[model samples]
Target: MVADREGGARRKPARAVAVYVAGGAVLLTGCASMPDNGDLRGVESTPRQDTQVRVFAMPPREDAQPSEIVQGFLEALTSDDPQYATAKQYLTGQAAKTWRPELSTMVLADGPATEADPAGVREDSVNFSFTLTGAKVAVVDAEQSYAPAQGSYSRQVRLVRDRKSGQWRINGLPQGVVMGKSDFQRNYTSVNKYYFASNSAVGTASQTAAVADPVYVRRRVDPMTQMVRSLLNGPTSWLGPVVRSSFPSGTALRKGAGPLTPDDQNKLTVPLNGKATQVGRAKCNEMAAQLLFTLQGLTPAVDEVEVQAGGEQLCELDEDGAAAVAARGSAKHPEFLYFIDGEHRLVRIPPGGSRSTNADAVPGELGGGERALRSAAVSRDEHTGAGVALDGKTLYVGSLVSGSSLGEPVVRSAGKTEDERLTTPSWDARGDLWVADRDPEHPRLLVLREGKGEPMEVQVPGLDGQIRSVRVAADGVRIALVVENDDKQSLLVGRIERTTKDVPGGKPGPGSGVSVFELRPAAPALEEVTTMSWAGDGRLVVVGREEGGVQQMKYVQVDGSTPEGPAPDALTGVKEIAAAEDGRLPLVAYSEDGIVRLPDGAQWQTVVKDGSAPVYPG
Candidate 1:
């Protein structure tokens, strides 16, 4: 820290250690030199008449003596008056003019020095160390205002010098000045004074000589940052319940704006291109439903609320909450868990089953049926608990759990898990199943392949928040997912391409690798589209109301390469769509006074004329 002279401000230069630890001992020893002695009166000086004479002309004899002329120069300049009268006798012209004024306030203390090749004559040189006290001016040009007044003072100074003249003189010594001028100068001025006073108190108050250590500095971390970092660190059993209560169904990317309600059924409409025509009517089976919810994996709770119509309670929902919740079935008491009644509800039923007023109502979990999913397997019996993914030949059930830092998913073969724990599931192109269990402690992505008992796990690096969406690209070269970034609305992409496991303190896990892509498509506009489906070709189809105000269908090709902006019309204007195979167009279904098909004249028969909504690929 240095102080300014004019402004009476102090400036602190952020000092960092550049010394290499490898050869520290040797380097320190080599740099050591004797302190500058103030005895300049006895030293030899540069010859007055021989000043212009070249040394080459004189034959060298023994070693030349230290210059008293140089020594006198130091003593004279360091004096309050600079001994200007005597200095004028040795220096003339420019040299005399520069030091005369500066020397008045320039104060010098003892400095270190070391003579090298003292016995040698040619180009003999000595290194010296010096300490400066009082105030020094520093020039700064930082973005902010400069600090520290010029006239302020400090006692700390450390610098070195290489002197060829045996006599010590400010003119002959290598010198460097530390000062402040601009933004840095202004800020540093206050900072220096503040910290200097701070360090002084600490030095005087504490028993230990160390002024400020990590113990004191560590207190500066903001409380919010620390809390966020903790959750980011891993799953905590103590926090599990709290996290669950806040996010009952975890966090889910829903299709609509309203809270997921019992009547809300997110359907997948497949658009059959080519020559598909509007069919009149055909017998239809009830549609299957899929629900996904996410919480930070902290807390879980169930509460009750009065069911109201225009702010009037038609009836009090069972103690659990709502009486007829879609996922929970017809329960005597329903808590409306996961907002299955309030919002984010996806429910569908077979054609004939819709006749019952409460066919898809929430079921009672009080009879030891539904329980909290807290194990690594994430098993839940209630409809509000977990989800199951079904491909052509197999079904994979999954649920998010919070007992451990590591999320390890359990997979049961199609007919195996009548009473087994479920896990997070996905399907690959070859009809193979993939499961991922998130571990908060270890923070990893666990992948389980079908028929293979032992699963593969890979460590995912610094995930700042709960994982949102995970998808494997068509090329199998990347695993894409949305994770919360610093800003809540935006997401950051984390990619891991290494084929080898790079787990710290352990072997690397298996993975195509992880990489985060920055793009997020706008959610399906539910009013315009009732359902959304991702085609094998990477296209997305939304089924619902299209342009013209009539129920219609449309699709958009995502291909993972779409630039981010307003959602393309082709993607959001669909009523329903389905993907059959690559190169084969997905079938589109909609109802406008009657089931209608775009592109006209292919499959004419319709499933149901007055059906509430059509379910594709159920």
Candidate 2:
């Protein structure tokens, strides 16, 4: 899918309608002018406004039976309540106190089926089990990490009658709630909480890089509180190594602090415990920034955030300040598309060009190198470039600016022939470069840290196919891979894991090794995916053929759902495609006509005539 960006209004071409005429042509004869009816009166109509307020779902009745209570409790889990108060009514006092609804969530494709086993019931208690058989789109864990899930889920619940009230209440059950796809859609909304990049220099003028952590919260349930709480929980395991949260180790919301609500002026006040009171002013500002960026997605955007500790305001930040920080960390893409010309000279096309134009060669030795270049990638900081030589055996890294010369080949293919050579290079937000050597004799995916040292092999378990392409997310946690096996192409998303250890001087250094884990199939409905790019957090733009045998471009959620939006026009004979982490940048692709770009609300425009590979900084 194309990134969402602002553009000029699209002018649709006027269409002509075909009118059918009977044998002799209905409009063959001309008629005289008719007089106006001055006495006719026109009636005025007013639109009816809807004034009915929606009633919230209620808790189970006091006298509800055990079976009815279980059913009601499951249904109540889908309600838009900040605390699931209604759902707790069906649980025993002790059980309710110990239950953690946020521990995990099971998202099933269809409603679950329950069956009661009276034979297992005791004198005052009954037992029941629910059988859910359907596709599991995804699962969210206690850390609010979303992972693609599949297969069936089953669990049991036990209930006993309350001695005084004589109402059935749950005594035992699982920690998290289970809901069907429809209820999940109605009650849960996917949102991203921002965290600063761990390697970002503090107090520096450089833009602070923000990583997006996507999670689902109850719809209409105090999203401001939900987002802040999730942010405090810290980044997920996959992201923890790459991003850092502002909240201190022991910091937490003040006791008795209920759901947070904004005032009429769009100002929100957050109360923290004593752990936050010891933090300095700059740290307090960082904490407020986390809240401001997370709350920007609310229906009525929050304008300002005030953080307090010990009943005293510690720091406050407005939307403008928070926006500046976010913008500063954002990736600044280059103003041109660079590629190898016919003479193997690195050339570039200026941004927003209507057609291909001759521009100066890329600065430095790369532009004048003797080795023919096949593909290349620019770094997110736009300070370096990685290129694959035309022979497909050598990988070169060099400065993007004018004065510096290209370095020696950093990686070489181990394949016996040209077919098993290096693929296109890709960069991650952490400044790591990734590429796959498709040598059949020694197939492996390698990562080069800042283009230094020997490329390390990344373990990809259960991958029996030939690696075709690799694209890493800007967050440096997830990777998109296109693999071909048995003449079929599969698009998979995997989580990257890195282990760090303390070095001699107590500095943290790379641990044993890096590996990719929990590989899951995405865009499963597509038959043959040829290319893909990370369009946004937890979202991808894929080019593939559907079951009907038609090639198309569409957006697919990481959970295997196709997002609702207009698909970009299909490009025939497209060689490659690239997108920036920021959704506001346009999409560029290397097609038969040259380097073509799809600007917001605009059709494809050729930016360079002879370019083969077009890319933006990761």
Candidate 3:
């Protein structure tokens, strides 16, 4: 899903997982076991004695050994240490196996200081809600900072724990957050190519923090008493606050304060014997088509397509061919349309066109727009507008006019006043222009093809509300627009009549292609779908917050089936998601927080923090 390039989405990747528990150990100790009732068919029919096994909660051992179970897990994950051998002293059963070979490794680590550090604790409880027998420990965060040449580094750690077995054992860990490949391509790549320093990657935590925290970089951290007090007293203070809040109030409490949710990062070694195939140029072309086609399919169709439009054999499909594309609405095809290739570099046309041709030339069609879009002179109103596909040819953009007069050449404003509120400009591949006026009350999405002066307006019944979001398939036949009604929870999906020009029923026959589906229960009430985009094959990616503080990102497949329920991995690990522009793999997830990326996951350079939510074009 793509975020607005101008203002980055604001969110703090969740710091740590929250674990809650109720009923103290004393309450559990006196509990009794009961047999099933005869009337209940699901329950066991046998009647047993009302008896109980009382297990009392034990106090923390004063002489408990300092087991480095949590720290060992973090070290093994971060610096390629063989500390997994030492982890068994603490972990047991399936947890031992899960911790054995780190599923994926993280590049850095952050946690509480070790025993050697000045502020370090000798030992502590690992679980956040431990009783006398069972303990649960979790890693909160792990971060590392390296010196030049990737030599030595300092690491920080945070952990949480619950009382258990009169002891603490570390349980879960934290995940890293990063950008998706498509997002990197569209927003950061080449955009900041000049600002990056040699030997340093841009958009990384260290680099971005270097720029973001100017004061911290310029000045030394003075060891002042007030600073110490703030660390111990202030709201943002990590150490002091955690100790006071997490540690048990009684003598059972040990040195450890909170559950340390260390980053559980590990990497696996795999052998790749085959030579990698070279499809760089072909791949780039597919990516461009996917991105542009989706936009064109949305509103009024533009006249021409642009995106390195110089390569001669670039793929092309006429208007009729585009409408034939259909999605069965299955899990694979959650939406009606989508892009095959989602991420690729877009090199704007140079003032002088290139003289190259054939196989020797670049794959993208860079120079075919009817009129060149001026980079410096493009309209500036802060509202970032993108080109939309209509009828497989023309591109449509809402035009900006200084005046509201309904001139013959200029599309008239839909507003009652003479104010220049709206105008639709249609352009062809060669940059040829056609202006069409839209109905003020019921605005139409115009589909313009070359030589087709009269544009097509696809019908959207029951669309009497403000448009909250819009997504157009890579092909022009399908369009999805989210409209917010007075109830705010309303979300509906509709198919457009690409074959006919009908309000309800018109032309040779009202196109059966368009049908609006109810998207209310699937989506939350009053929550907006902020980032909406289409993947190749018509998968719908919708990211937004729900009413119950649930931040959701879901996909609707165009194959005509409901998607599977989201698993733990999909919910917590998804950093960024992009559609492959080359169509090799329609979907690509960026960084998976703490879980190491899959061996086959797409390659991407690390991104520094610039306060923007990751962008995924496809």
Candidate 4:
């Protein structure tokens, strides 16, 4: 317990961790940080659990003891003080000038523990020292990228008595800030930085698909300005190989620009430096589109974005113009959720609707029930459909239009039985089809460019297990796979690298060999993953079971972290599940209850009495 400014006792929250002072009983409890402004609002309130209460940092008391000064400085680091000005007051002149808290954040498992240095305890000593220690859980870099880390953390902090004032101040410490896990959560919010897929264009098409790259930024800081700067800096390292930035090589916001905010008409004007002034009109528009899509998630949403350089407007883009350039995220909304009905035929229904009978049979051969189907996929435009035979021996490509005919099997599996054959087919944003052949004799991942030509075997380096299922993201760069080995299945997200290297056997392959490598575990805790689908820009809806546990459905991010939202309601006997990239759409699944849908804020509703595989257009 600590005394309040009014001489009352302040109780700590249940989960609060304590930072001990070096020579006294003073304890600093963890708290959520906010921006120091009257206009601050609850966008995504931190886990501090005091949403209605604001805690202001108390400055150092007059002639304070060294222990109190150390305790106050640590508490101020977790407060909502703007630029941490109050915290700086605890540091000496040279120490305040050298501290760079924005460079990085060191997240600990609990509040740091402080111990007095034996050498600084003498009465004649003018300088006192202490050791701050904790167990590090992760680190957030200057680029705002969060990566898991593990190790012991120890730093020496030194304080000296001011000669003129006879007051103690922190004179030596590390550059970055340190806090507990809960404090870190309250201080940052996740935001997606939009980028264009490097391979979205096919044939002569010019438009590209937008990919979402999520990052964490300090919510109370200058978020609008920080976000624009991150976008200009480009994508994270894991996603950098497959995506490209529309901004010129060295483009950046003009130096010393004020905080970025939309005008009364909901227009955001981005003034770039001279490096971006020479771009053509078409390229400039693409840059503006990226900005609009990236900023659509924040509060006070802007309706239009203008790009300016060298004091002149280069281009402008609204929602409509952004959609025409890069199709994805809020710019595009899916029409329906698809599934294989009781008759093992392809069917469709309005996403988030209750109708069932009127949703069967899409069109042409796929809807005609000419051949028994085990799984199916529809292209983004809902113009093409790919179906895998019930026996899993062949994959057929057909048009989703009336009076259209199904062509010969696009690809066939040589597996001896249904248990080892082609997996569900998937379509990419660039109009390509992907499938995996699980034949024990020759397992391979295959891709069909433009849904035609010879089947190309995709190279997957460093894979030690058999591929059971595959789902391609809307971005056309990241692919999710459920690989099984030694009776255990793992959910892995890998980068799609289109390379010039030859096939695995040193033989020339068609359409420039593409490899899926650098795979990272998306659900490292789950013992087995039954099925999954891309649910958002950087999130996936997964169904799996842990060791000695019942099956569960949850959303996992591409970077192996749990998201902020609640998990979908639990369901039993779920064999296959599907979710649209648009979060507004309902989640469809094929469970023991047959085809079912989970509408927003409602329990599961039956869509039909029988169905197996459910999916949304890629």
> All models: lDDT?
0.25, 0.68, 0.26, 0.78
| 48-128 per-residue lDDT for model 2 (tens digits) | 111121113356654555555665566566554557787898888999999999888777655444445534334554343
- Listing every candidate in turn, what is its Cα RMSD in Å to the true structure after a full C-alpha superposition? 32.0, 14.1, 25.0, 7.3
**Model 4: lDDT of residue 236:** 89
lDDT of 4 by residue, 506-603 (tens): 44465677799888888877889999999898899999999999999999888776778799999989999988888877888889998888989899
lDDT by residue for model 3 (263-366), tens: 22211111111121122443323322322223232213322222222223323332223222211111121111111111211111111122211111111221
The TM-score values for the models, in the order shown, are 0.23, 0.75, 0.28, 0.83
Best by the TM-score measure: 4
Greater-TM-score candidate between 3 and 4: 4
Candidate 4 collision pairs: none
Q: Model 4: C-alpha RMSD to truth?
A: 7.3
Q: How well is each residue in 26-55 modelled by candidate 1, as lDDT tens digits?
A: 010111121123321111111112111211
Model 2 residue 81 distance off true place after TM-score fit, in angstroms = 3.0
Q: Which segments of model 4 are wrong by more than 4 Å?
A: 1-70, 89-98, 113-137, 149-175, 202-206, 402-408, 414-417, 500-511, 546-549
lDDT of 1: 0.25
Write the number of the candidate with greater lDDT, choosing between 2 and 4. 4
